[model samples]
Target: MTALLLALASSIAYGAADFLGGFAARGAHVLRVVMVAAPVSLAVELLLWPVIGASFDGGAVAWGAASGVASAAAFALLYKTLAIGPMSVLSPVTALVSAALPVAVGLASGDSLSALAVAGIVLALVAVVVVSGGDAGGVRPSREALVLAFGAGAAIALQLICLDQAPHGSGVAPLIVGRTVSSLIVLTAAFALGAARLGATRPDTRTAAGAGALDSLANFSFLIAARHGDLSIVAVITALYPAATVLLARVLLGERIGRVQLAGLGVAAVAVSLLALG
Candidate 1:
């Protein structure tokens, strides 16, 4: 129960962070957003380090760094895809792919769940697709956008699986290392490619910082939850983040909630209940 709750919390944080990131990216280059956000995330992780208590393991650090690199690729591609494609198509595809990969890994690793839990996982996956407004009208996605979305989704799944490889009780040390690695990579690329001018408006900088802090919190929550629960289940629940993001859009941006999305929310509630019962 505690683990499920943590996973849900992570989903919420992830959704909020992504929302902020999307907003920031609209005003600045995606690479610039990543470059600024990574350092802020790193700072937050560092601040939490002493309180969280850390274990310095070389293997864990290596896994975290690998996850970071994957994450950097995922975000860059995701942002790029969103900029060019109809989100209705890309969002659901990405979410489904991300959820499916972890489930595959967990099953292969011999993690077993009850029949009820399995049903919940299936329903959760469906909910992610429906809640993304996949049926909504939008321009057809280009081939490039589809390719980028798939790549981003695969990278995200890899990031989650890799993060789970960290040894138990490593706390947020892996996250710190991951953030450091990702930050440097993005910063270096941004300058080397001259993709974006470093001079961002104050508002954009603040938005980037907020997104980074929330993203760091989401990572922390997921790491803790993964330690306490089956990776398959945790990943599915976390992948439901688009639900929160959609809800936030409706409430804050006055975006209309489609009937499909409402139905998805109801289904997601039932799915969570089933998982908890299992």
Candidate 2:
């Protein structure tokens, strides 16, 4: 369908995946979670192969590999950050950075942002901060946790920017290549960290698998959305993903959603609507 709808789908999927990934990481080692998640993502990509089709070229491979490396970093850092910090707050920090970087790059590369889209992006950035402030009365995050969150956001932005560079007809090949490369990276890291062993009885394995599948779906939606629309607009709209994560946290974990955060949700809706109209 439209890029706006597709981007929203991607955002929701990503938020859910982050929730699952964070929950799984708290009980098990981050490497173990990533190790399991990567392979599951690869399997999901393979399943999408026939449906989307693919054509690989040198440029696509190079760009996809770049995205894979960035994704490896993003997954490791983001999972660990979420494990240590409050997901409601920390996730929005990442989303803001991710959207900001892409918006800068896309604009520099002549993505053509209209006044309305720019206004929406400004509001989206505000929502990222306000939505993240939902648990303002809770414990503050450590400096290390904030660093990791920032790094993960940068990595995530790089991953998307690299993926957007792939040729349009290349279809899902870039994502397939990205997943394979990421799986290998995470696997290598897991083995080095002595977290590679996977027993069938591990309770978190199912959680990790679920996260991976959802992540793959999110990646697919984002890539399609970026291909069909302005990267700047798509990135900001997708950054509103914190709304989903925050709302999910309130429902599933009994987290308190303050008035400020509730207002942020309304702002997020207005931002997305402006982006769509723009």
Candidate 3:
């Protein structure tokens, strides 16, 4: 499939995972939710092993491990951020940063993008602010959340670029390696912070497991996109994920999208359409 299609699919899956993961984090500890999600994701990756035809190289494994660590950090911060802030604000902020860092890096390295694509990036940046809604007008972002979110974005941007740079026919293996390493990191953090105790009952466990599986699917699809397309464009397109979050909010949570946010989403759509055409 095309990069556009892959990005759209990845964004929707990731948005749903974030929405549910955020909801689940409200009652459960963020670490606990991540703990529940991690192992299931590992299993999913294992199941895909045969179909993926994965064979690991030492260098790929190293990069994948780094990516996994970054991803683990990202999720830990994201889930924790959701616990304290409104989704409308947290989602767009992290998403925008995630996209911007990679695009900036690409440009600095002399990666050329089309005029329309440049316009798309501008629109995406605007969408980030717009989707923040009135929340951006409120209290400043918490110091801790801001730090974690920035760290996560930087890690993810690097992961996208590095994963794209990894050798062909070895993409899937590195992704698997990344997830495994992420699980280990989350587990280690849980142990260090004493948050490793199982808290959820069967029902919550089931919900978290489902969330993990979805996340794994989303991650893997984006991994494919990174493997197949330009790192900058793929990251930018995938970062348009807030659109899915808004759509989900309307349907599941009955959350209203104000005029500003609605306009932002429309602009985002046009941007993605331009990106695809480019």
Candidate 4:
């Protein structure tokens, strides 16, 4: 129960962070937004490290670094695809692909789920697709966008798997290592590509910072959740983040929600209930 709650909280935080990041990216270079956000996230992880108290060997750090690389690649590809594709199409595809890989890994590794839990997972997957909508504006994704979206999803799956490789009871040290590696990679890439400019204005920087903080929190929650729960279940719940993002848009940005979205939301609630009962 605690693990499920943590995973749900992580999804919500991730959705909010992505919303803020998307808003910031509109006014600044995507690389710049990432570069700025990474450092802020890293700082937060550093602050939490001593309090959490980690115990791990070099193998954990290696796994964490690998996860960071995967994470950086995932974000870069996702942002690139979002720039060129109808988000309605790209978002659902990426979310589904990301969740599918983890579930496959879990099942293949002999992790057994209850019948109710399996049903919940199936519904959760369906909810991601329905909630994401489908070419609402009738814009088709370019071939390049579709390819990038798949790549991003694969990278996300790799990131989650690698994070799970960290030794048990390592506190947040693995996250700290992962964040540091990702931050440095993104920063270096941004500089090499001439995308290191912070922002055209201070507000952009602040917005990026807020996104960074929330993203850090989300990652922390996910790491803790993964430590306590099965990877398949945790990944599915976390992938439900888009629902939270969409809800926020409706409430805060006054974005209109269609019947499909509402149905998806209802289905998502049912899925959660089934999982809890299981």
* CA RMSD per model (angstroms): 2.2, 2.0, 2.7, 2.4
TM-score for all models, in order of appearance: 0.92, 0.95, 0.89, 0.91
Candidate 3, 173-219: lDDT as tens digits: 87788889889988988788763454542227776787788888888
Q: How accurate is candidate 4 locally (lDDT)?
A: 0.79
Superposed Cα deviation of residue 89, candidate 4 (Å): 4.6
Give the range where candidate 4 is weakest over 10 consecutive residues by summed lDDT.
Answer: 194-203
Count of backbone collisions in candidate 4:
0
Which candidate number would show the highest lDDT if scored against the true structure? 2
lDDT of 1 by residue, 1-278 (tens): 98899999998997787767766777457887787788999999999998998776997799989989987887687766654545545666677788899989988998889999999999999898778664444346788978987897898899889888888778887898888888888988888876336445323888778878998999899899999999999999988887766666557655556788788888899989989998
Candidate 2 structure quality by residue, lDDT tens digits, 1-278: 38999999999999999888888888667878888898999899999889999888987898999999999998999999988868888999999999999999899999877788889889988988888776645767889989999999999999999988999989899999998899899888767656245433343889899989999999999999999999998888888877777777778777678898898888898889888778
lDDT per residue, candidate 4, 126-154, as tens digits?
A: 99888867444555778887788789889
User: How does each model score on lDDT?
Assistant: 0.81, 0.87, 0.74, 0.79
Q: Which stretches of candidate 4 lie over 4 Å from their true place?
A: 83-89, 134-142, 195-203
Return the top candidate by TM-score: 2
Which window of 10 residues has the lowest lDDT sum in candidate 3? 194-203
Model 4 steric clash pairs: none
Name the better of 3 and 4 by lDDT: 4
